[model samples]
Target: MRCKSLDFIFDYFQQIPTMELEEITFSGWTAIEEKNLHAGEKPKDEKVYTMYHGTFLKYVQHIITSGFQRSRDGMLGSGVYVSRNIDKAKCYPLNADKKEAVVLKLKVRVGKVKKIDIDNHPLQKSWHQNGYDSCWVPPNCGFTAIKSGREEDCVWDPARIVVVDVACCLDDKTRWDLRKQIRGMNNHGAKDGCSQCHQNTSNTGSHPIQSCWTCTKQICPFQKKHVCNK
Candidate 1:
């Protein structure tokens, strides 16, 4: 299937299985200050700084398990995108409902950094090629796309980033709605075989395909290796 948007795939995968609400333990996890940095400030060289990564709730468990993956293309090509500003992290997965949004607190080791404040910087997307470990975009620097007027950063390597914690960025009512949806999914799955597996009975003993959001076919497309291109 066409990749379309990351959020689109995540929308359908919301019923893959409920997220384990229990606290997760991360190895070698180090805590950093939760405060925000000034608009034009850069992280201390070769030192760890606190950062945030915004994403939908459905993908949280997967990310925590698999770790951050580098983006194939971005303002700073081939990097794991993050921001020191929590508000900026709260603005991601833009096309989806905010109720499913979450901000991941992280500890990042920005080995060497560069600034790309200009619209036409020679290495706007190629800073990694010049031995830079990260790129910084200052707020209100004439980048029309950053409506939040917030600072953003792109780390070249995902290994340099470690997930510290996850925070839900929703109001009480929205959180209620989220819990309701999850409970509904769980209840429905209990009654209807499996949502994700549909009729693919091979793995029924392990985890039945509860109700697949994709289609009603006996086998899920995803099980056949059909999935989002991106």
Candidate 2:
């Protein structure tokens, strides 16, 4: 009877809903902006735009913790590059595998915007020097260097770009890794696996199509039998 009660309690706990990091909703971007930006620094137009930044999966946690850093140099001079269109953002960190890419949703304070349409625009790399807070490149602006044929933006200050959320594409490799982790935790004789399965006494545990990991038999074959001697 004690064992049955323990089993019931374990099952109940397992059924409880748990929230993961990815499942958490983000709505505090305004609070972040309010705390970081002063009234004198805010743009007169004060229009906040949604943008995205593409990077490697390895940098997601670091960016979230430490915030974004301005790039030393780029096509648009030294600034953090982003895009209003998500498709354009996803094409970033160029020449890398798409499976490892991640996109960060950002809230940008694009104050006093400037457009650099032509290849040799005088302010192409010095717009910030002339008091422009951000620069935009329109789609298909007849620039030979604009390979994506999409619009792009570069914000001069990293503080103006607030990360709102992280988006990751779960490709085959990511899925396989997740499955492996779940299996390691759910197998018999493992850390969180069935303690009743004595057959799988070593580190390795078996998982065969709803079968018992201990004796490799039918699912929960010994649940009513009270003991498994197989």
Candidate 3:
């Protein structure tokens, strides 16, 4: 992707450990046992239920890499994934804008945070490095959902009906062009086959699909585009 960029979270992937990834939802690995029932729920000796952790929430399988996808306006995508080399996750304090509305507690005025909008991951807008969309997520659409209370209900929509702005320079064509480029790189091995499967273990974990780090200036139809001060 291309654009004029100014500011970006520089220490890419610092908050995360880079490692090999795996598919946690494969059924052969998970087994149903009578003792596996939910709290206070009884288990029939012959009854079996698939395990929930490590993928496969209910019957639908889950992606285990690079995280989710998002639109420029904040709409999220269908799947939430993680990387192969992960053990745990870390959470931050809350932003004033997120304190009440968002469930993911975050720190104040820190990094460029955004909800991946995919699968309602908190800290979607995160301070840590790689806290954007997974390799599959876009740049302009940089909001993070932080929680998963009513995912099917929430959407990645521009907050309000937009009116054309006059000051911006990049037009629809450029924006579309940039987005297309970024998405196309999804399968391109970022560095060797290491990027073969970029995943996020935590739902709130970010999997930013980066464009040219140089293109920091993100233009939106809603506002006048300003030159990003690099």
Name the candidate that leads on lDDT: 1
Model 1 stretches with alpha carbons more than 4 Å out? 1-36, 169-230
Using all chains and alpha carbons, the TM-scores for the candidates as numbered come to 0.58, 0.55, 0.16
lDDT of 3 by residue, 1-230 (tens): 64334224434446567788885431111232343333223222223222111221111111112222323333333222221111111111123221111111111111122333344455433312344322223222332442422211111211111111111112455434433433443334222222313211133233343332344443322121233344
Model 2 lDDT, residue 170, Cα: 55
Give the better candidate number (1 or 3) by lDDT. Answer: 1
- Sort the candidates on lDDT, descending order: 1, 2, 3
Which 10 consecutive positions of candidate 3 have the poorest summed lDDT? 102-111
Q: Can you write out model 2's per-residue Cα lDDT over 88-201, one digit (the tens) per residue?
A: 888877987877887777778788888888998999999999999998888877866778777778898775765655544557565454345333433433333334432221
Q: What is the C-alpha lDDT of each candidate?
A: 0.68, 0.66, 0.26
Top-scoring candidate (TM-score)? 1
The global Cα lDDT (0 to 1) of model 1 is 0.68
> RMSD to native for every prediction?
21.9, 21.4, 25.9
Of 1 and 2, the candidate ranking higher by TM-score: 1
